[model samples]
Target: MRVEYDDVETEDDLRVTYQGDLFTGEVVERSPQGQVIAITTYFNGMEDGLSTEFYPSGERKAEGSARYGTAVGVHQEWHRNGNLAARLEFDDQGKLLSRHRWAEDGTPIESFVAES
Candidate 1:
């Protein structure tokens, strides 16, 4: 994946720099503090492959995959403390298939399945 930097505006009042494109490469976003906050991949200008995000403290917050700009497959989330948060599964059409949640302490919370 190509890596470059460009200034970008954000609603959180922090300047971000985007590295890479939404096609055949991975885009990495860096916070104004120079911390890598997110990394997403793209295929032919659409979101594809693995996507990941991290807390400002460098802890992973979320991880998932996208297919042609839509969320698909199994996705996972976590708390900044490295605790399990949620897990979701989706179909190729971006339809939710199943979902499960857990507390930061690893306590099971709830689970659900998609209709149809």
Candidate 2:
């Protein structure tokens, strides 16, 4: 699979296509003023992966992956100023697998698994 982005931002999605076949990706979200708000992705035309990023103010807000049209994998949450608030990981079945507090920056603090 291959992916590309002309000017992928908080308002637009990062599309992924395989061999000219539309595989998956997120959708573009725009502000009422016509700028951008967040981009939520879909799977085969379903609410699967979603990445709710913030505007130009510097806030991560929310960004992550999903499976079978559900939230899964690594999920990032942040403050309004583009700061990382939390870093959480989930299982394939939408189960909370791990979590970690955000660091001073928006980067993932650390990886810690949850008890099964």
TM-score of each: 0.78, 0.57
lDDT per model vs. reference: 0.77, 0.62
Candidate 1 root-mean-square deviation in Å:
5.1
RMSD of each: 5.1, 8.2
Report the error of model 1 at residue 31, Å. 1.8
Q: In model 2, what is the error at residue 21, expressed in angstroms?
A: 17
Best by lDDT: 1
Between which residue pairs do clashes occur in model 2?
Answer: 26-41, 58-81, 58-82, 59-81, 59-82
Evaluated against the true structure, the overall lDDT of model 2 is 0.62
lDDT of 1: 0.77
lDDT (tens digit, per residue) of candidate 2 on 1-116: 11323233322244343344445565555556655567756565345655666665434567887765567888877776556778788888888888887665666667678786
Q: Residues 10-115, candidate 1, lDDT per residue (tens digit)?
A: 2232222343322466668888898988987766666678999999899999999998778999999998789989999999999999999999889999899978
Off by over 4 Å in 2: 1-25, 56-59, 101-113
lDDT score of residue 12 within candidate 1: 36
